[model samples]
Target: MTSTFHVRGGRPLKGEITVRGAKNLVSKAMVAALLGEEPSLLRSVPDIRDVAIVTELLKVHGVKVDRDVATGLIRMDPSNVERAHAAEIDAHAGSSRIPILFCGPLLHRLGEAIIPDLGGCRIGDRPINYHLDVLREFGAHVDKRELGIHITAPNGLKGTKIHLEYPSVGATEQVLLTAVRAEGVTELTNAAVEPEIEDLIAVLQKMGALITLQTDRTITIEGVERLGGYEHVAIPDRIEAASWACAALVTKGDVFVQGAQQKPMSTFLNVFRRIGGGLDITDDGIRFFHPGEPLRSIAMETDVHPGFMTDWQQPLVVALTQAEGISIVHETVYENRLGFTSALNDMGARIQVYRECLGGSSCRFGWRNFNHSAVISGPKALHGADITVPDLRGGFSYLIAALGAEGISSIHGIDLIDRGYESFREKLTALGAEYWED
Candidate 1:
């Protein structure tokens, strides 16, 4: 069951918290370990629900998974991989989409994979059809069963060309993991080039996959007959790093986010600076603080990689609640991302959701029934309220709202936050946040 957090607000969180591996990549990286013939070592793995879920799923399939939580080092062995029953797989799948991606690796080893239906954050419509489509292009026969998805490659998987209608990260990953082992050459047009995808590519390359990156978001992979293992360190969680930074801005606090990188966060930092957030960045990490003055509001848009991330939208929106003047946010990635603003409005943030496009170029959601844009008129004094956490990113955003509000806030479903943030309660305590779990 999910727990509740009672937070006494209006406290400036101080001190430091370290960010570990990217939650987005680490789980998939563990899945990639199944493609290897020998043991693979992944370092800087975070202690999170996704990792734990993926670990248990892999273990159910007879993959030997071992980890040192203190050091964030994980060693995965796929030498004796076996097929897990649907019930076994479904029990471990618990609220993670990683199970679908496992079909590619499992079809290669066991010739068939029964994956439970997908489930995760309810941010928007994230259909698994894209993954299914990519797998079909690679010669895998899929049968939709009552309980789960059944996939097989009776003739053995073979590579083929594919063009995505949308450059989805999960679909691109499905192509990469499957293509690396299929026969002949595979070329994917309009593939997602997120930093996490790049990191996964690096891991696959370390396992003897021949892959090529083109200038125009095209990836070509030459299937190899056999593959070995790899030892590598994962990139830090850019999303988490930016979240803590947003917390600092919202609560008028100071925080040193260790292990936060600069390259992946350049776009977010630029926007953060324009919004009147103070920062002292270094080779080690970034120290985010309040400007000690009024925070300025600005117009921003969430986009694909090398642009502002959609995941960074919620927490930063809470920070925007403290800024003077109106802030416009155009969420081009997810159609319903602005839905979290309802709770913030209850806490005194004046955010309005719109069905029409605002602040940026037109997107796929425009001219539709979906409310994909938002306008926040801020410098509003936030008061505490009873709220339930929604999704991973949105849950953390609620904590930021609670910390900036006056009086006590009763927040439930905080365990959802553990799906991404590692040891957040301890980190909150270290930062002097007056909160207790019940």
Candidate 2:
């Protein structure tokens, strides 16, 4: 079933929108439940496609997942895990990065695991080599087969010191999950320090795992014989919050984003304020707008945690198009993320993509046609046009662009947006957006 959104443009969105759990964290937390010996309860779990994917994957692994539609609560019991059905597993193998996380938990509990290829944002060649290397360090033998990844723990899995070449989020999580149950202590250096990673660690620690976060980028986990269940409330969706903040900027509207944490979004809020955007932050939420000032252009570069997030770049670029001067964006994360700018160009945005890294910075997408840098010359009038959303965040940027355009826009593949955004249509309607199903 395909769903499309038809949006009539030229509306200034005004309202308070609350964001649910982080999509990036919920799926990983679901996989983390496999480490438990009993049932685990997760609160603030959003009813998005990715969560559904993780739920179906967990159920196929012989675990029962009970979701409360009213409260957004998820209860997972992995005590009776069986070998996940091959056909069902293979069908969603390439669906998201969360599946690869099963390699550690499955191998630990069942002595073997077969994980299908992973799928997520098409920003670069996201290889699981780091994951495989970390698992091998933990005494697991990994083999690549025609169907999927075959991982076996013949020696029953022993912990070892594992150092990541890069602070890849998936790789760091894989090491933590696999090493926690091994025979000896595991020391992981160069770990990804994203807030979601910290949240995952909290969950693991609550399950009776002994973990220590030392300064100078080192994490030590002492192997435990068994792990108990945990109840955790997932972190608020910062990506969703930033997306709505950009929506407020592009439409020149006032939006109060509840459930947005200020600490995790300091970098984004700093950048937003630097570009003549106004924000009022409280302990619980943030309000974004521009009060009595023309929007300015600012240079931004994406980095890991505590830096400008690459996912926030797309929607902000749409807002930057209306700024008076040239705004430069350097994406250092996924290489192919800049492709969506071409779709914005079709809607009369003056954006030029560059293959070579600009602003004296290096990036993962610098060499490929990924176009690591984008220069937006704006204050140009944008007319509504038909566009396709290729990924989750990019889909919302299209919606923001459509809202700021004149006339109407027909956006296809809106189901992709629902993978992350919860109650998206209802939220837009409350914000005074004119949209309908077709």
Candidate 3:
């Protein structure tokens, strides 16, 4: 069902909202439970849509999933891991591309795996070619079917060396999930070394897997015969934390985000400080606010790790709309991530998208026909306008814009925001946001 919200603006949002586990890491950690012979326990789990989707997928495969509400713990027992019907998987997955990661662990457990058509946010073209190519190199057979694709390991999976064309996070995760139990040694070049990837590697290590990493984007894994269950507390969601930080800057309010760490968000914190956002870091969390001064403009670029992430640029773009001068942002990760600027333009913000690299750096999309860069001219007052949510991060950006606008904005497709944000409506209410559901 499509959900809509009406947001009354020109008010600051202030209060404390606690964030939970990282969505990118937690769901994959749940999927990693399939490689275990015993029960696995994950703590600080969030009640997000991706986790719900992963839980449903695991249950249909004969894995028992139990959640404890009080302690926020989820125990996944994959002792009876078996094959699931394609129709059931397709029905439960519902636009999530996580089913593809199941091929490796399922092949190791049941000798075959069936995957339905994969879908996700349409911000850009994210093909599964890198994932499939790695699996094929590891001795898996792929057959194309009408509803989906069928993958099987006839002679068992054998680890091999692979060099990724791009540092795709999903493809790197597929390798880690499959290579843990494959025969012999597996070497991966150009692997993603994001914080989520490190968290997954830690969980795998706790389950008795031997994995090694080098500074030069190389990961080596020694396959074992079996793996046991793991007990871990997943890292806090960095993307969500940065989103709230941007929200605080955009609305010119104070918000203390509990469980937000400074280490993972160092790059974002630097940008936030440069843009004249108020920040107070404590042992437990971070407090973000406005300094009652004019917001400054800065030119920035988004890159892989140790750089401003692509997911962080959207809400920050809304904050940038209030900055003094023209702020330029070059999105090097996803080609079409700057598409949300059109809606901002409609809301009276002066945003111009360009096909060239506007941030003075050359990237893969610079030579392509995609509009990968944006110039936001600010100090422009935004009036409320009706807008439909596009993707997850973009949807949250619209919400930020709506709350900071001068009039009431009718925002449709807020359900997309639940895929990443945990208890956002409740948090919004706690933060004194004026909004209603429809």
Candidate 4:
């Protein structure tokens, strides 16, 4: 059954909330467990839909997934891992793109990997061609079937050099997972160097893999004959921390995010300060609040790591609705990210989507027909409206708009938010944001 949230607006949210492990890192780490010859212990695992999906996917492949929910620990034993049926894998991995990451590990272990049609957020065209091409580079033969693609390595897998055109995260992950067990060293240039990728590298190292990061965006993995278990602590959820920070700004509230780190969120923190949001960076966590001053609007662009993240742009856009002047957000990451702004516009915010890159250098989608940029004319008082949660980040942005509106908002498809945010409703209640289930 679908769930809905009835949010009563105009009250500022206050108090503290804790964020868990990075959603981006945790799932890939779980997939990395399958490469180990022994059980891997992962700490700080979040209780989210994606984690659950990954857990189920691992269990289907005969990995023993033992959980300690109280302490957020998961012990994944891959000793009994075996080939899983195509239908079974499809059933557990519904609407998740994680199955593609399984291709590398599964092909190494079982000599074959079957992946059903992949699904993820509709923010852009995240095709798996990069993944398929990477697999082909490693001598995997792809056979298309009615259900999904079946991939197999006739000869044992061998490492090869790969250079991504756009530094796609998934392609980089595919190379890392596959190259760790291949026959020779793999060199990858123009790779994604996000913090989550670094954490994954740490996990691989603990499992006896030789990997190195260059000063440039290049990664090298020396293939090993065997990999053992890993004991690792996943990184904090910077996206979730930034999302709460934006929530505090939009509602003119004060929030103490208990586990936020300053390093990963440095770019976001800079943008938050430029937008006139109050922030205090500390050793433990970051405190975000409204400074009781007029919020300023600024031109922003979303790029890869070290730039403003595309995931952070959605929730931050909700706060931009309350800014005093025109704010231009050029989304260089996703083509359809600004579509969720339509709901905010319905709530009395003045946000216009444009096909041309308005505030920054022309990006890949600038000359294309895709409307990838947004111009928000704000300080407009927002009212309540019925809305639908589109994707994970977009869903959270809707909740932010609803909480800051002047009237009650009826939100459908609220379950989408659970894919990333951990116990957000409980945290919202603790922060004194008035919301009820409908």
Q: Write the per-residue lDDT of candidate 1 for residues 315-382, one digit (tens) a residue.
A: 99999999999999999988888888999999998999999899989999998899998999989999
Worst 10 residues of 4 by lDDT: 1-10
All predictions: root-mean-square deviation over Cα?
Answer: 0.8, 1.5, 0.9, 0.8
lDDT tens readout by residue for model 3, 70-135: 576999999999888899999999999999999888999999999999899998989877778889
State the displacement of the C-alpha of residue 404, model 1, in Å, after optimal TM-score superposition.
0.8
- Candidate 4: pairs in clash: none
Model 3 TM-score is 0.99
Which parts of model 3 are misplaced by more than 4 Å?
none
Give the alpha carbon lDDT tens digit for every residue of 127-217 in model 2.
Answer: 8887888888888898898878889999888878877776788888898888888888999898888888899999999999999987667
Q: What is the clash tally of candidate 2?
A: 0
Of candidates 4 and 1, the better by lDDT: 4
lDDT of model number 1: 0.93
Predicted candidate 4 versus true structure: per-residue lDDT over 330-362, tens digit per residue = 999889999999999999999999999889898
